[model samples]
Target: MSAPSPAQADTPRSTGFLLLFALANAGGVIGYLPLLSILLPARIDAIAGDARLDLFTITVIAGAAAASLSNIAFGWLSDRSGGRRRWVAFGLALTAAAYAAVALATTPVAIVLAIVAFQIAINALLAPFLAIMADEIPDSQKGVAGGLLAFAAPVASAFSAMLVLSPFTDTTRLLLIPAAAALCVLPMLRTKPRLLAIQTVEKTLSPPRELAIAWGSRLLIQISGAVLSLYSFYYFQSLGTRPDLAARVAQVLTIAYVLALPIAVLSGRVSDRIGRRKPFLLAAAFTAALGLTGMAATRDFGMAALCFGLFQIGSAVFLALHSAFATQLLPNPQHRGRDLGLLNLTNTLPSLLGPLLAWTLATPQDFGAVMLVLAALAICGGLVILFIRED
Candidate 1:
């Protein structure tokens, strides 16, 4: 979107608009994440069998490479065009088509191509949406907005997994539901963008050192959390359970997320009401570290889920606050799309790294090493947050 004029920047949005935006975001999350987190790996294993890891590795590598390029390119395009709504609509349409192709593909090559396409489409949707937040949401409500965005993930995860994994074993429904559900948010995509009032703050970026620390802190914690979730099914199997038990892992994580939602949303509301972000962010980081430590120390499924739930609660808090905080730190209000795209790398690039880290540190025989590594990274993420000056 074009740089908001000073008047546009000061305009206020209604609560209804923000709620719709959050729901729109949830549509995207529901569309992609279940496929990414659960089904794709299973599908890859089905196709590649013994070579699933090798092929899955290749798929992730290719998809991440595509995502990194497409995210920035699309953000630049949206900025140049001075519009985001059309791009978002187009992305949803394209992703629906891609999901259909994925469902129909019998060959590994075709499936990988479909996945790459889906990644590009999803990122196209995401980058512009985030830019919209920077353009429209006032600073006073950013934490609330961020909490809404954060709230979508778990709600979507639980709903989508139960719908796809439990009720139907057919591939068509698995793919088609995401395609259809994505359109649920299309109503929110009105022709015009609503602008938000700005709070008193510099429009320019924070100091380079502060920005770097803030960015790095999120990067480290996200890598750890993403890896933990991405391979959770495998992590379940490693505990010596039956193979069928893998499907139940999503349900377990769903429970964790369900438990985490209140804590995340309430923490965010409290932060916004009190005009503080750093303390909550730091608390989340340290709490995540403690939870990860417990996850590493236990092998029992019940105990592991409890620990993982604790981690999820902390992660939910951190992610919401971090996004709100990061937007405030953007270097150029004129380039919010481009800048947020770069910052979003901290989200996508971790998907690429998490697998490699898992491969190196966690073997089938021993998953604790990866958990410990994540714990340490989370601690580091917390420490770095100490360096950023919010005021």
Candidate 2:
């Protein structure tokens, strides 16, 4: 560990900053979730018809590749420039513009191009924004911060349900989602928190090895998340759900995430207090695996929904705690932005792997095989974390 830089030593603690930071995370989720999970699929189905899956796969792969590269680039750029706020604001503007382009797209090719642009813009926003947490939030508070971060999913999911259920036109909905994100983000942007007060600490585990293990664990887990996020709408349809019930499905997703909120917050707080994260992380992984396994074995819509809720609870808690754990393992404070960007690959790379897995094992009507595979991966992710000798 190293001494705090002068700027870092000047940082102040404020509940307002944490609240705004969580809201900003929700804003980021809003920026992408509704678009990727609902709107984009709907658009592709409208334009590509029976071939929507093929087009969706292509578009997602392209977007993921763009995101993978752009995240690292923007993170490094923010690090070099010694600022994250301006880059994030610029990325938000670009994201809005890209959304407009996506709305105006009339063909598959055009949609793919627009999605690639959107991915780049969104990652530019996400990479720097995440780095801000590592740069400022104290280790003692990171668990609570990660717990707060869990709020983003339900907020975004609820917004997705609203967009689907409302009588608003697709174009109007597209416009409104980004505006809602801006409202969440703007408050954080307006309030500048002072830098973090970094302190030297004895190492418990080698940072490089711990980070590598954490990265791999997250990548394995996220493959399932990426697959589910992109395919849940289709999955519900496969359960013999009426086409008009998309909003209902979105509502179910919202409820699942909402149910996970308290558990995530409570577990995170407990982990912080106990100075232990692995137990919660392990429990979350196995719980998610159980849910996915149950989902694979059942075809009943009600049962599947219940299982999905269980999975959401597990995934949410895992992500929240793992985030705090990983931040502590970051090897270099000075390069926190860039290192976190590298970690972002665990997120983006899954988009690629997930599609490949889905294309190979799943059809428009059958997702059971893919679900089982995902369950196995989640278990493996949990097992991988055991290799790390960290608290």
Candidate 3:
């Protein structure tokens, strides 16, 4: 292992810094997701004809494989090097290049390759950045930081929708703009040397069993959410039978997430004050289950939107706290980047499972069965969390 560079050492923390950091991470994530969630499926249909679903599934499978490998590998490297800024900077630069590649892709194979590259680069960006969170944030306030981080998805989704609806219809601009936004926050990552006497000590390491239980619980809920999110545009298209209307419905669904952002942030803050994570996480799971069930039972777009909004609120709460709690559960503070990388398996695993589950259970006309499966998973996620002893 190389000696610690001056840049790898611990830096001073501030509220403003955390905010900007979260924003940058969110921007980078949104850069690809909107295209993934909104544009890619339709684009595949245009390029590949009747095999669009197969192409979408294959691409996601490949991307998932890439994400899983890259996250853990880069995380291990970051922990060993004790650095975040350089890796993030490199990731942002690589992500920009990958997005440009996506913009130029003319075939399904080309698009899939681009997507894989993007996923790898994005994971590289996220793994190191998340490690920085584990390194810097105190346990008492991690929920607050997690809440701020949770805002990234909704905000990015909403922004993506707006871009789609705008006159800038070029895929190049759509991809590049968010890439630029991601890089804009790079200055926030500047680090200073660690002071040897200062140590973060509020939270003890959680038991391995407890951490595993929490991981399982969170993984199921994340899979459920992934199923809903990845197929939302297609689901709406089936309902309306008009591409434009489906896009509009997808936009509305994303707005629900944006509206729920406050609830997510508040839930984290409240959880911090109460000093409890299990209850909020449990409620999040149950709420998502209810929403998934409601969506399955409803035919009306309005009703479905309401249901999905509920799910969004619940999911946001769960994910925000999961971030904080997962960080606390790390067995080795020195290896936090690598450990969190393992925890991130929960996130990437769903990209594989969610799509496969949807392909097996739901056709374009029969999302109800898939929704039921998702609801069941959400319920199970909540139930599993009961096994964890917080102490």
- Winner on lDDT between 1 and 2 is 2
Query: Candidate 1, residue 51: CA error in Å?
Result: 2.8
The model with the greater TM-score, 1 or 2, is: 2
lDDT value for candidate 2? 0.88
lDDT at 319, model 2: 92
CA-only RMSD, every prediction: 2.5, 2.9, 3.2
| Candidate 2 per-residue lDDT over residues 1-391, each given as its tens digit | 1222444432445778888999999999999999999999999999999999999999999999999999999999888987688788888998898889888988999999999999998988888889888887877778888998999999999999999989999999988887898899888877664566445422322468889999999999999999989988888787885857678788888999999999998998898789888989999999999999988888888899999999999999999999989988888777878989899999999999999999999988889999999999999998898887765
Worst 10 residues of 1 by lDDT: 1-10
Q: What ranges in model 3 sit over 4 Å off?
A: 1-13, 191-203
Over 88-143, each residue of candidate 1 has an lDDT whose tens digit, in order, gives 87777777777778788677898779889888988888778778888877777788
For residues 1-391, what per-residue lDDT tens digits would candidate 3 score against the true structure?
1233222222334677668767876766676667777777767778887777788889888998899999999999987876576787777777777778878887988989988998898888888878877776666677888888777877777766776777775676556565555654465555442211123432466777877988899899999877777788767665657647645865776787787788878888898888888898999899999999998898787888889888888888898888988887877777778888888989899999999998998887768888999999999998898887775
- Which window of ten consecutive residues has the lowest lDDT sum in model 3? 1-10
The parts of candidate 1 lying over 4 Å away from their true place are 1-12, 166-169, 196-205
The Cα error of candidate 3 at residue 56, in Å, is 0.5
* Top-TM-score candidate index: 2
lDDT for each of the candidates?
0.78, 0.88, 0.78
lDDT of 2 at 352: 98
What is the number of backbone collisions in each predicted candidate, taken in the order shown?
Answer: 2, 0, 0
Q: List the residue pairs that clash in candidate 2.
A: none
